[model samples]
Target: MLAQTALAGATSFRPLRFSDDGTFQISIFKDLHFGKSKDLVSYNNDRNSITVLNTILNAESPDLVVLNGDLITGENGFLENATVYIDQIIGPLVDRGLTWASMYGNHDHQYNLSAEALLEREQSYANARTQRMVSGHDAGVSNYYLPVYGSDGSSDPKLLLWFFDSRGGNYFRELDKSGNIVPQPNWYNKTIPLLAFVHIPTNASLAAQTVVGIDANSKPGINNNVPLAQQGQGWCEDGTNSNDCAYGGQDIPFIKALVKTPGVLGVFSGHDHGNTWCYKWDSELQLPGVGGGNGLNLCFGQHSGYGGYGSWIRGSRQLLLSEEALGRGELDTWIRLESGDVVGSVSLNGTYGEDLYPATPNDMTHS
Candidate 1:
């Protein structure tokens, strides 16, 4: 029972619900860096990225699609061509009559390009579910949530999907007087489950990699040859040594707020183009005062675009949530490569980190 409202010739999505089979599936396409330029090479890359998206969407038929972040390379765009990428990026979803939501990534902000412009373009499509701040609100653009209702037609929502704009790159017009941004309000019910989507990986996310290494035989996923560009950390090239960068603790407040929140099943991030794996956030990560052993999983979506700086085979991460499994806070996720093969299949539960999963094959490995 998909609900929609007509708004000036465009349909507005409302009240997302699970299927009659009591299941909901979400496909995440992260780092789809489109619109780098109008050159032939860039055009071909964008087309291939779209083909990958179409393949996965047709194969999975997911209930929702998430453009996780870095949807465009803002620095490569101008005011005239910046937002036109939104149409090409969302074309597949619209063609299929599927709905979607997005978060702004580091590269999404630039002197000429902005998250506000992107959101405005996205909202023009009836199936686009991306949201922005109201008149009096001052949070970053794309910081919002959508509720998912159960198949049983109840007024109350069964799950919530939260989207946060990490806010990076050169665009910095909107800011609070205090220079601090609160991603969301405290209006959610603690009893209901929720999942978070943000572009930049938190500091804790890098910590999990050391605890859960990418050993193909056991823990699976590609390892970025370069150091992870975490939140509050500059690019690897900006470091003093230029070879090794240091992590700044500026993102601590956001991490603390996220871990302290209740009913967060998992947090998904995309910034590092070569890293993709999920690990539990436990006391070993060293966020003092923040509860760490709460069965929360920090996962990364596979690099899904050709425009980013990576040779990794493009693919999208798929999450399957069952209405029956929600009570136990269980979720199953895996990466679906462009070749149509599934890898890194793991169930995010109590024993997630210790769990074994298939590794990325040699042919699909990131160079």
Candidate 2:
């Protein structure tokens, strides 16, 4: 049914370009559970997760690659084997012409396809811009926004990348019995220092992991514990209890539009397949009765496929940025692994303490 005005008077998209050393790398490949059970050992573990996503895009030569959702593993009875595991998870980012985008995991339309058939197989990929649901409340469908230009390639954009579609399942409904689900309000417009990629991790990421806590590759307190996602289910809240996939925790106006949007600084997710961390949501920890803004940064991603279930170890999540680190508004992230080993080296908007490396200043250009 896909046509909610198919982006009516569409605007915004066709920006994300930056790399003649002005920098703008990103890479977050999340859960890739590929065809849940299409056998042949799940297509040889999604072809060894596309050879660990082509050795991290030929060693981090990224200017974008965020198939940040489950990238397949639907319950398939053969919707063309979910388009052959979504063309083997975007055939190594379309054989390296690279510039990519995607989001939507709740087992990505669980079985036989239908998040408008994975948004019509990612709009036949010409490096997918990933946006849909022209209006609102079809619950979710990869909300848009992706501008990053600058290195004299400007038409206005220093950096900004927001993509939401945290939908997969659970249709909240419980106005009574104290199983809450009443709060709802939203807003968004103009923001920078941003970086959001969703596929479930709201509930203000469990109130920013209860004011900055869980990190050594996550999952400590809060009952939405990651990995295999069944013991209470990963983050987000409100609990009407439909076997707790922890749905969007009543969303609270998209977590108050990510704490009043403008300069968000962080917010990344992936259906908790053994959580990799990056906390700090401190705007003085609100949400006690829900309402407040200016707290940003909350991360998770590093489950880079292998057909999910997590023994930990598969990786992804990178970032980078530049143009004098976005003119010192900060950016530079990490997580690599798949045996290349880089690990949680944070610094987006500066300091959440992981391993701090910081030093890649040579490329500079912004005008």
Number of the top-ranking candidate, with TM-score as the measure: 1
Please, what are the lDDT tens digits per residue for candidate 1 over residues 286-356? 65434464667888899898887877888999999988888888898989988888888888877766767
Which 10 consecutive residues of model 2 have the lowest summed lDDT? Answer: 358-367
lDDT of 2 by residue, 1-367 (tens): 1222222222333667776778878888988777657569776777788888988888787877888876876655245546556666776666666657787776665434555567777676656777773455544566777787787876988877878766654322324468643322111222324777777676666655555445443321112343223212433454434534444345565666667767777778778765666665665567654565454667777777777674556778888888787665577677777777575565656444444343211121111
* Candidate 1 runs further than 4 Å off: 1-12, 134-138, 172-193, 211-218, 235-245, 288-291, 362-367
lDDT of 2: 0.62
Residue 177 of model 2: what lDDT?
66
lDDT of all predictions: 0.75, 0.62
